[model samples]
Target: MTPRQPEGEALPGAGVLPEQTSAASSSGRERPFSVYLHVPYCRVRCGYCDFNTYTNLAMGGGASAGDYVDTLAGELRLARAAMDRAALPPRAPQTVFVGGGTPTMLPAGDLAGMLTLVRDTWGLAPGAEVTTEANPETVDERYLAALAKAGFTRVSFGMQSAVPHVLRTLDRTHTPARVPQVVAWAREAGLETSLDLIYGTPGETMDDWRRSLETAVEIGPDHLSAYALVIEEGTRMWAQVRRGELPLPTDDDEAAKYELADALLNRAGYEWYEISNWARPGHECVHNQAYWRDWDWWGAGPGAHSHLGDVRLWNTKHPVAWAGRVAAGRLPVAGHEILDAESRELERVMLGIRTREGLELAGLARLGPHGPEPTTAHGTPARLVPVVGRLVGEGLLEGAAAMAGRAVLTLRGRLMADTVTRGLID
Candidate 1:
């Protein structure tokens, strides 16, 4: 889930962090190099979703889907100006992800046109990973093939569950049968396919989840992401559960589902790269990795968030307001944050511990913001060694990685990663 509204004002050249240069380049010039485009139109609003997306009907002529491409173009121009004002140089993206209320709901050519816009504005790097999230029922072979020809390297389908009742509970529109068909289409178009699933939905049984998992794996997707349903406040699911019309999944059930997913996916030859993500050896989502690796990315489109070095910014959320601002030649940016060194270090520890590569012990040694560099026992501060030792003794950290100065998670640690992180950073 995203913050409903932006938090800080958009400042020109003001969002660049202390340690970063403005220019974005590859070839040894380390940079946060990706772009995200958000398409806020949806055919219908799903009960469980609280994303910043509006139904076409609910939008009420405030924003036109046909005008979205031009709106995004205007936003891109504004992005260029904002970065230039910040003295940040042109940042060609290495990864581009198009996400939405269902990006595929747009005309096939419109989606392609958006990618072409990215290509023209800031040339994508060679072999760059470009992805769009798709709804299973929203795409056909011709559409998928057109996207492939337009330089979309991957497509992730929103296939929440395999059972009809489970899907009905979540308000998903696609049938379970449509999933493999789309995967096949994507593969035929030479696009890597990933399936996204949700577990722990109300009325979903263990057997139901297993059927979903088995079906997803049997379809041969290159990657899979199974998230536990989070019923955010203000969402329809939240209201229903609150009114006693729906029951929330028990925590124990949730844990069992998580374990089941990991086991089944692993047995199917997919590696668990992050807590909820799995992929065949080379099929990991590059755009997502950029986030987990602490690389920066520019989020285009309304209500999207961007991070450059340590500066985090988000655009105005409403499509109508966002389009209006961009049409008047304003950056759609609504708020931003320039993360202090302490916040940065803490974030690094938090994000890193959840990944397969784990956190570097060297990272944990630094002082918060302007504090003195602490004295070191190994690569990190001397005081942190006991904490590291304690976690290792508890089997929350891989013993070898600790000896080698990294905080890789043990199997048990993966289940309670936050607990281990608190021991290190708290």
Candidate 2:
């Protein structure tokens, strides 16, 4: 769910973090970087969505879909200028992800041009992973071919469900048969594919959920993401539940579905790389990895958020307002926050504990005021050893990883990740 945008003034060189000056000169290249492009248009607004999206083709103020990329180009230039103003050295993006309201809703050429714009402005890293989110009903083989020709490496299809009733409940507008056809087309076009699924939709049965999972695995995409349905406030689905038109999903049901997904996908040779994502050996989504790893990236487009060092900035939400600011040659940023050291540490432990690689104990050892002291045999501060041991004993953390100086989650730990994070951070 998209939360309320934080308030802050847009100032010049606002993207710069204090440590960037030193890091930019020395070990900056050690960090991974990526770019994100947000497309705010969708054919229809789904009942369960609270994302920053619009269904109207023309929202006035020169913000129509036709010229949307041009405005995005303006933001790209602004992003470059902000980095330059900060005296930050140029680092080409290692990954670029185009996400949406449905990115495929735009013409293929327009999406291609946006990628081209990114390339021309700041060159892409060699072997850069460029990905776009697609709605199953929006594209054909020809369209998929166009994206591949534009240096696109991956396509993640939003195949929310295989059951007609579940799809109907979620207000998804694609047929079950269309998924395999699109996956075949994407494979034919030489694009690595991923399928996204939603579990625990209102009125959905365990059998219905199983069918969706089986169908997705049968289609054999390179990667898969299964997200639990979250009925956020202000969304239509939440209203339905409030009025008793639909039942709220139970945690017990969703947990069962998650376990089902993990078992099925694991048997199919897909490993869980993140809590919600699974992939074959090397097929993990690098663009998303950037977020989990706290790598720097520029997020362009309306309501998109960018991270640089300790700074987090977000663009204006309304398309019209965003376009107007960009047309005036401004950065289009609505707000930003420079994270404090404590907040940064909390975030580090929070995000780090979610991955298969686990959070490094050496890093956690540096959290105390003494900072960077020698660690114990397990590579953690002596004070934190007990906390780590407790978590390991409870089966929430992997004992082998903890012994090896990292905090990896067990399958049960994935469901209770928040508890593990608090144990590590508190």
RMSD of each: 3.1, 2.1
The superposed Cα distance between candidate 2 and the true structure at residue 75, in angstroms, equals: 1.0
> lDDT values of the candidates?
0.85, 0.89
Score candidate 1 by TM-score against the native.
0.93
Write down the lDDT that model 1 would get.
0.85
lDDT, candidate 2, 1-426, per-residue tens: 445788864554434333432223123455667899999999989999999899987887868898898899988987887777776678889999999899999999999999999998789999999999999999999999999999999999999899999999999999999999999999999999999999999999999999999999999999999999999898999999999999999999999999999999999999999999999999999998998888888888989998887778889998899999898888888877777778888988888899999999878766448667667886787778899999999999999889888999999999999999999888
Q: Clashing pairs in model 2? A: none
lDDT of 1 by residue, 1-426 (tens): 333675674554332222343444323566758999999888878999989887762443335888888888888877765666667767689899999888998988999999988987788899999999999989999999999998999999999999999999998988889999999999999999999999999999999999999999999999999999989998888989999999988878988899899999999999988888999999999998999887778898879988886678788888888887888777777777777778877888888998888887876565568885775555767778889889999989999888888889876788788899889988
What does the lDDT read for residue 59 in candidate 2? Answer: 85
Error of 2 at 336 (Å): 0.4
Highest-scoring model, TM-score: 2
